[model samples]
Target chain A: MVRQERALRTREALIESAATVFDRDGFSVASLAAISSLAGVSNGALHFHFSNKAGVADAVEQAASERLERLVAAHGEAVGSALQMLVDTSHRLARRLGEDVVLRAGFELSRDHVRQGGRDLYRQWHAWVEEALKRAEGEGALNGIAPEQVASSVVAATTGFEVLGARDPKWLSRRTVTRFWQLLLPQLATPPVLGSLVAAGGPPGDHARRTPGGSPAARAGEEDD
Target chain B: MVRQERALRTREALIESAATVFDRDGFSVASLAAISSLAGVSNGALHFHFSNKAGVADAVEQAASERLERLVAAHGEAVGSALQMLVDTSHRLARRLGEDVVLRAGFELSRDHVRQGGRDLYRQWHAWVEEALKRAEGEGALNGIAPEQVASSVVAATTGFEVLGARDPKWLSRRTVTRFWQLLLPQLATPPVLGSLVAAGGPPGDHARRTPGGSPAARAGEEDD
Candidate 1:
């Protein structure tokens, strides 16, 4: 049991290290030696767990996928409409991408040609958005706009935030995303359903931290771009 | 005069070669030797033209900026609404991105952290969109939607398509972009002005090749994504 636990922890550490390097240098130029060293693991151990750099990237993608799944699941169980859940998920995701290097790297690596056959996180996320929108439609929560169009817009905007945040971390701030939702939700929701959705991003709890523009008043210890 | 012309041609060739390399291998990994060899120029000649890799990137960015300037100017002169000009420019820019390696490379290099203080094409483009939307507002072409909000959506979607197209060229195709505009214009244009906008992208002349999905029907000569 002790050995098993140690092995799992080592794997997690290596994946995190690989994500850091991949995120910094991009997948094509990132090296396994850098990843292993960053993880503080031996060369032999790095090889024993993953065959190569692609393997390490796959592990990172897998971890990120699991994390995303958990995030979706948690938000999916929201008490109100699925549309609200979708909006909350987008806000939560923007926050996660800001804070989590592994999550960001998962997206970056998925775009790289080096990791052929690895999970295409972008497509997966897009499909998930579509599903959520479809559920919203079924619930009669959507307005006159087609769910696909809304899904495309949401996916594009969220994906754009991730890409822009790569250079300017401010793009991923809650305020920026909130502003995005603020403009979009009005058009997306019918007059009857409009009151239920939170354009500031999340439910009442999260609204306190995220203002209309998405600026957090005094949140400290957050890393800069 | 002949020698001066030769030098100018060599400089242009070197910059083109550098763009191809930088676009393919990225800025950090691209080698100056490869660029010189690809241009069929001597190492001394290449160095004489540009001091180093950053210099080469700067040259490429300058060329791309010129191209973008010409494109924006051509579209900006439209006799109709500024909103229409904005739409036409997006279509034209998307097309240029598909065909122009230097333009695409300029954007990629701008995103790269190594090329700090290089021309931020994304910011430049974003600012341009804001200006165009402002013009639209001045012309009363805009609906009730905030120009800033519309600018954000347009910039994010256009940028997203460019980034997505890097991996799957289809995302950058004329059809995909046209569909984007088709979905967006209804929300952007005032009721009286909606009829004037071309959701299929550009004026009738430019729409000859593009279908709804961007599939090229028998244009064998055109480059595939």
Candidate 2:
């Protein structure tokens, strides 16, 4: 078991190194020698683990899919009002800002390889988001629309948010994410109960939330106009 | 001007060819010779136009940006309900489906020295979304919430939808996109008038939309839950 664990660590090291380089250069130009050098292993060792560049990339893509699936699952038990669920998922969302590039790029890579990990990851993510919408619908969240519509919109929003956020943390900060949830989730939450959830505290831990010269809440409300 | 036009065409040919090659193959294996041959130009011509492989990628990135910018500007006349604006943008968005590798990769080319176009593109998209949300508020289409949040969510959702749609046209068909507009835009449209827009056919000359249950839509909504 200990030997197995060491072998796994070497494999993970190669993947981590590959993710960073691929996130910077992509799988094509990032050479095996470079990846091996970055992993502090010899070419022979890298070859032992991954036969070549695509082998490393394939592994990285798989790990990225698995990690994303785990993240969504971690937040699975927190389903509630859109705002509350978003808030619960807010930190999880914010924490991953910009570093989720491996997964983000994997989706694009999937386009090239139809059997790529990006497709599977998104499939899983959409499934998770769909489940959330159904629960929200059962709770009387959507006013009168199909729960499917809400699910599609939410999944799209989450994937887009992650891709953009992985590139720029501020683009999908805690408050920004919460604010998004408050507005859109209301469309799927119990209509009467949405008011309270939407009115929840101004993005928990954000100091810059309120904006200047006017309350942040007012600015948010202005958007609704 | 004739000489300039000829040079421009050759340069464009190089970039276009290179973009296709890179999309199909990673940076490491996509040779300039292959790219040149694909464009029906000589390797010497390709090298003269782009001093380096990275130069070719930069030009492709620039071209993609300009094309995207042009598309957005063409839709500049989109005003009134944020929802309508969103729906109008879908037409433009649809055209990007199955475009060159550069548009799909956007920023995943970290291997080269090129900047990730994803960041700038997303920021621009977010700003545009934010403005539309504000307009929705002014028209009294919103439910008195923060536009930034809604904007982020809308931006996230739209980008996500487009990305997913690009991979599987069936997953994000014209109807699926319209459904997205129907689901999201109504929440932002004022005077409670999504009935005609959502249920109505596409803009003049566009096809009439089916009521949301194609194989792709069915599969998508069920998972993006």
Candidate 3:
């Protein structure tokens, strides 16, 4: 059991390191040597966990996909209305993306042309947004506009925020997202549903806060010491 | 005069070739040899025109910027209201970006981390959208929403369309953009202004149509025949 746990830790470390390097250097230029060095693992250990650079990237993308799934599921369970869920989820996503290098790198990799065929995190996110909007439409939450149109707009704007946030972190800030929701909610919700919707949603906890060493992998490494 | 014209044609060919390769291979992996070969120009001619790949990228960006400026200016002259101009310009841009390799390459390079300290086409587009929104607000064309908030939403959505369009040309279709405006315009414009606003805008000319060999540089090459 102890050996399994150690193996898992090493895998996590490698994934995090790969994400950091990929986020900084981009997938085309990111090197396995740099990833292993950052993870504090031997070259042999890196190869043991993953066969090649693409394998490392796949692992990072898989980890990010799992986190995104959990985030969506958690929000799905908590919110009463689909529109409110979307509003709250957008806020949460922007916050998490700001703080999580793995998530950010996964998204960057999705848009990247170099890596062919993996879990496309953006498409996954877009699918969820589309599903939520359809649910909202069924519930009579939306105004006269078609659900698909709203879905397209929401997906585009959120993706924009993600793209721009790379250069300026402010694009992913809670305030910026809140403002976006404020402007959009009025246009999106029906008059009856509009009164109940909260554009800001609930406050995110300390986990959502930005930190210098932000990834869960980094925090786990700290615990070992 | 003939010599100067030939030199200009060679420069255009190199820029077009660079945009095509950069769009396909991305900045990091793109090579001068590939660009020169695609342009059908000698390596000597390529070097004479551009010091390096970055210089080639800068020239493509510069050309894209000029086209964007001309697009905005043309719309500004044709439309009476700032809001109308915004709508018309957006439709034109989506169409142009779909047809123009240089414009698409310029935007992709703007978000690319490999290159730095060039004209950020996205930022330039965002600034223009912001200015238009502010002008619309001054004209009392906007509803209750703040111009800044609308600007943020518009910029994000439009940028989203640009980014997503890279993968799916449908994202840049006139129908998609028109639907976006149809959904947004009612919420954005005052009831009085809403009545006058056209969601589809005027039809784009044949020049805006997608072609296999679309770039003006390619057309200029054809003229030589």
Candidate 4:
């Protein structure tokens, strides 16, 4: 049992290291030797866990997808209007993306045309956004627009944030996501629903507590008009 | 004058050929030899025109930007509300993206991390969207929302469409762009202004006639709802 746990730890380390390398250098230029070296693992151990660079990328993508799934599931469990859930989830996602290199790298890899055959994080997120909007429509949270139309815009905007955030990290900042919702929510939700929704999300420290040593300070103090 | 004209034609052919190869194979795997061969020019000729592959890519990006500039300028010439101008320009740009390989490849290359120091097409589009929204606000066409906020979402959504369309061409279709405006225009335009706006854009073949041998036929028949 102890040996198995150690193996798992090593694998996790390697995945984290690979994500950092991939995030910084991109998939085409990132090297396995650099990844293993960063992880402080032997070349043999790296091979044992991942057969090749593609394997490492696949592992990173899988790890990121699992986190994304958890994020969606967590927001879904909360009792609220689906529209508010969508807003809150987007905020949380932007924050998590800022703090987690693995998640960010996974999203980046999903769009990298050079890489092949991995989970498409954007598509998965788009599916979730679509489902949420459909639920909101059933609840009459939406004004009169079709749920699918809103889904396309939401997915596109959020995916755009991710892509733009890669170069300018500020694109993933809370102020940016909140500003987007502030503009969109008023148009999307009915009068009552709009009043009930929090475009700025739950609270500053709502999800920050979950990530130990995660600095919320870096994300604060932006003029949010 | 004949020599200069011939030189211009050769340069244009090389840029067109490079865009085709880059679109199909991506920038990393695309080769100068293949580009020249596809252009039916000797490699010595390719070298004469471009110092290297990056030079070729720069030319493609420049040509694409010029086409985009012309599309924007053409729309700006028509006397209309700034909001409608924004809508029409978006439609024309989407159609151009679908038919024009150089334009499409230029957008793809803009987001490519491997390439460096070229005009950012998204930023240029975003700036234009911002200016138009500001103009609409001045015209009292916008319903109290800050133009900058709307601009951010619009830019993100449009950029998202461009990025998503890379994999699935449907995202860049007139129908898809029209659907986006249908959802957004109502929320964006003031009540008096909304009635005058056309979400489906000017007319079929309005700008499609400009592209020689272009097929608007392939783009037709998608359900608008």
DockQ of each: 0.29, 0.38, 0.34, 0.43
Q: Which is superior by DockQ, 1 or 2?
A: 2
lDDT of 3: 0.79
Candidate 1 TM-score, true structure as reference? 0.87
DockQ winner between 2 and 3, please give it: 2
**Per-residue lDDT of candidate 3, residues A1-225 (tens digit):** 999999999999999999999999999989999999999999999999999998988888999999999888776455568998887788678878988999999989888886784899989998999899989999988876677777777888899899999889888876566666666677678888887776655434423453332322321001111
lDDT of 1 by residue, A1-225 (tens): 999999999999999999899889887778899999999999999998999887888999998888888877875464568877887788788888988999998888776643584688899898899998888889887765577767766777788888888878877776566656655665567667776566545555644455444443211111111
Candidate 4 Cα deviation (angstroms), residue B131: 1.6
Please list all clashing residue pairs in model 4, or write none if there are none.
none
Q: What is the RMSD, in Å, between candidate 4 and the native fold over all Cα? A: 5.0
TM-scores for every predicted model: 0.87, 0.74, 0.89, 0.89
lDDT of 1 by residue, B108-141 (tens): 8777764664678888899889999998898888
Worst lDDT window (10 residues) for model 2 chain A?
A: A213-222
Q: Model 3 off-target regions past 4 Å?
A: A203-225, B203-225
Off by over 4 Å in 1: A114-117, A143-145, A205-209, A212-225, B205-225
Q: Pick the candidate with the highest lDDT.
A: 4
The lDDT-based order of candidates, best leading, equals 4, 3, 1, 2
Deviation from native of the Cα of residue A78 in model 3, angstroms: 2.9
Runs with alpha carbons beyond 4 Å of true place in candidate 4: A203-205, A209-224, B203-224
Displacement of the residue A176 alpha carbon in candidate 3, Å: 1.9
